[model samples]
Target: MGRWEPNARMRLVRAAIDLCAEQGYEATTVAQVVERAGLTKATFFRHFPDKREVLFAGQEEHAALLTAGIGAAPEGVAPLDAVAAGLDALAASFSPEQHEFSARLTAAVAASPELQERDALKTVGLAAAMTAALADRGVPDPTSRLAAELGVLAVKQGFAAWADGDRDDAGALAGEMRTALESLRRAAATLG
Candidate 1:
């Protein structure tokens, strides 16, 4: 029983999410989270630099896998399609059991202004990483950045919908993201 105390970092996230779900994200304090997790500030600091960062843990491997997926995409595949596929492959790395906890964490992120700002910064960083990954595959400037943004946004929206819903469609996040990217294409066509 002592061996399974929610992995320290996950305990903090679970505590924060529970507090956020019960009250509001802004209303939840680090102290409250630590208290609920039966942990100290030292343990919290060891896991995350701050409260908002607790939600963004373990993204390094996701980026590495996404880059590899893009690099391995067939030459004929378009940039957006490649990105969609990459994100799908990334989603495949996580299991459905992780989805429920992650969904609550995401909701906590959405509910907090500080976390939302941090989330935006994280998205920009992800876009840059995607752009760099695609550039290595011979894709060019503005298009690469735009496609990365669109692809990630789609994945975010799709995951958000699935996470908030009571369905087993979290795997649908990649395809939903693809549809979002297509919608952007249609909208751009309308504008021009």
Candidate 2:
């Protein structure tokens, strides 16, 4: 076979996902991941803290993007409007090329209860990060938290549709997210 190329991080991620899908998440190990990636154990550690982190690597970037998006909202925008803007900004960070990877990663996450718990924590962290950003802009309590949560819901809904092969229906991840946000608003309106 050809020599393994040296993109250790990507290779490790792919290997981990492959192993988890083939065997099982709980059955997979860091050693197996490294072996599949054609890399050393040290390389895996260099990239991720542990097996769980392989699937969660994007979370830090996600939080940062959400924070930046909320922070950049135009001054004095309504809380929900600010959240919508943030969702739009964050959604713009993804491209169609990422859809397949996201779908696979999400599937891997779904296969393991531990991974699901981590995903839940990450979701809460994203909401907290967004809330902090909104609060920084003087968004009041309840408003900040509520708006941040709404944005998180929009993200979840959008990504679910996007990763579930709705690419043709939504056009793009950002568009899907915006559609989700609008749907949330409409639903909330009816509750009043």
What's the CA RMSD for each of the models?
2.5, 2.6
TM-score to true structure, per model: 0.83, 0.88
Error of 1 at 123 (Å): 0.9
lDDT of 2: 0.81
**Highest TM-score model number:** 2
- For every model shown, the clashing-pair count is 0, 0
**Clash-forming residue pairs, model 1:** none
lDDT of 1 by residue, 110-192 (tens): 77788888888877777777888889878889888877877667667766766665655546555555666677767766876
- What are the Cα lDDT values of the candidates? 0.75, 0.81
* Candidate 1 to native Cα RMSD, angstroms: 2.5
lDDT of 1 at 176: 59
